[model samples]
Target: MSDSSRVAVYLDFDNMVISRYDNLHGNNSWRNDNARDHRPGSGDATDVRLAEAMLDVGAIIDYASSFGTVALNRAYADWSVPANAAYRTQLVDRAVDLVQLFATSGTKNGADIRLSIDAINDLVDHADLTHVVIVGGDSDYIALAQRCRRMGRFVVGIGVTGSTSRALVAACDEFSDYGDLPGVRAVVPTTKVAVKKAAAADAPVETAAAEAGPAKKTAPAKKAARKATAAATKAPTAAEAATALLLRAIRVGMEKSDDEWLHSSSVKSQMQRMDSTFKEKSLGFSSFKAFVESQGDLLELQSKDNGQLMLRLR
Candidate 1:
């Protein structure tokens, strides 16, 4: 968060997209789906889960945040295609500037070229920039990373573990595997009854009752018995774990800050830091905001004047 450690991030979107797509189709990936497939005549639904599973924009940004204040964030891709277009809103939501590159000849090397040029330009223009974080495993970026390091800027590379090029990882001062990054844990789907029961058990009795005041008054004893029965029926589900993680993070953020409310982003980052594999998508939630809103009974969400969401733990 300091000015002295300003960081700039450049993403080769296509490289990441394809890498994740292949990773999903690889062996032993039972949770893998065909969300990132853009084959001809394929009708892929516009689900946030699919896009997120392909390239977790939130995890990437959160990882970048740990290095320093992210002064510049940009992703290069040809957005005209559905593959890249599907992630536009997500990237924007994370405040990442998109640089669209059109495929002119054989392959769209334009994005790579553009990203390198922009990175150099940013380094030259911004004196405070101390780090250049490149998010892609392509060997083509080796030169870019080396150049940044030669110019006295710390270069960090992020890539999918299996798909990343060895040379690309070696070129940077530090390389982070995307899957190993915080907040990217794979979410395994489980029975809804199990999840519901876990949530009931985990829910603070006073808070849940207070939130359910009207229902409580009608049948307090019966409701309490029902909750007990439900908890006894099943153990904590993945959703419950995810919810608890978020609530714990919100509480931590609130305790640390002077303000009572915690930024949704901060809570998410904290949760991931606590467990790198934690991801809302893993809990069957399309997005973080959706997952938070699903727990409306246990938390209060308010939109701040700055257009950011703040969460108040019940």
Candidate 2:
């Protein structure tokens, strides 16, 4: 896809909220609590527990912006629910169009159908939208992803990790875990206590002799642990990681170029596309050229006859 991408974002708000809740609490805990009946702006709506796992609306939209300008941003959910209403300010602040869907039954919210229809309509109407960002994990979106790709638009999927369907991931051109997005922390699963309790209940009773013997690491295992510790202590610093990223970008740019050397601008664009959050200035460099020159050990830079700078893998 072109670097000058026009992005259209479709967010399934309820799907994200419920998935995040299940990720933090036990599975289906939100449903068990009868979250739908929780009135807007009520005590249940402002529950501290739900706030802990509340989705970061700005983080997702900011990440989408990295692809290109977000021309159309829409979120679908039943706004009457307090859980969804809690995000009204953040959504409005980011200029996201709130598309509300009323619940027809306890289990059947028409978010998926409405979101799909709206996305299709937008794509049909807007020829300039080159990228489609689907912000939900439902397998129902697999067909939408396929259809969007068939229409020559790059489809990006953002979904909660465990709650996301594997089939949906395969269908999209690119897929990102919501937790993995910039400014968002990964959700630590809350099943550890339950797992420990289950293990204790099912654990076999040990004989006196077996209980007396505590397992010891073998000599080889000890040596491996020592090696691993050494490696961890010698882990790459941030500068080294940035240099590696630059080198990889240079290699990719060179591979795609028809000439012997790739333009400096092209390499930088490749880096930004590979990592939307990448910024040479953020790494203490004055400019992209300065950043490239810093990695002199792994890259070669030269000026063309017309004074245009070019780079190649050393």
> Which candidate gets the maximum lDDT versus the true structure?
2
Among the numbered candidates, top TM-score falls to 2
Clashing pairs in 1: 185-277, 187-282
lDDT of 2 at 95: 79
Q: Which runs in model 2 stand beyond 4 Å of their true positions?
A: 1-3, 39-46, 187-314
Model 1 bad stretches (over 4 Å): 1-3, 27-52, 187-314
Residue lDDT tens for model 1, 1-314? 34357789999987887776556444333125443335322212213223334466866775665666778999987777666776665686577788878788844557778899999999999988998999989888899999999999989899986778899888999898887765465633222234355456646675776676643222332344344334323456777768756765665455346888888887787777545689888777898888999999999999978889888877
Shift in Å, residue 125, candidate 2: 0.8
lDDT of 2 by residue, 266-301 (tens): 767656654567787888989888988988887788
What is the Å distance of residue 201 in model 1 from its true position?
A: 38
Output the worst ten-in-a-row residue range by lDDT, candidate 2: 40-49
Pairs of residues clashing in candidate 2: none
Tell me each candidate's RMSD, in Å, in order: 16.7, 11.1
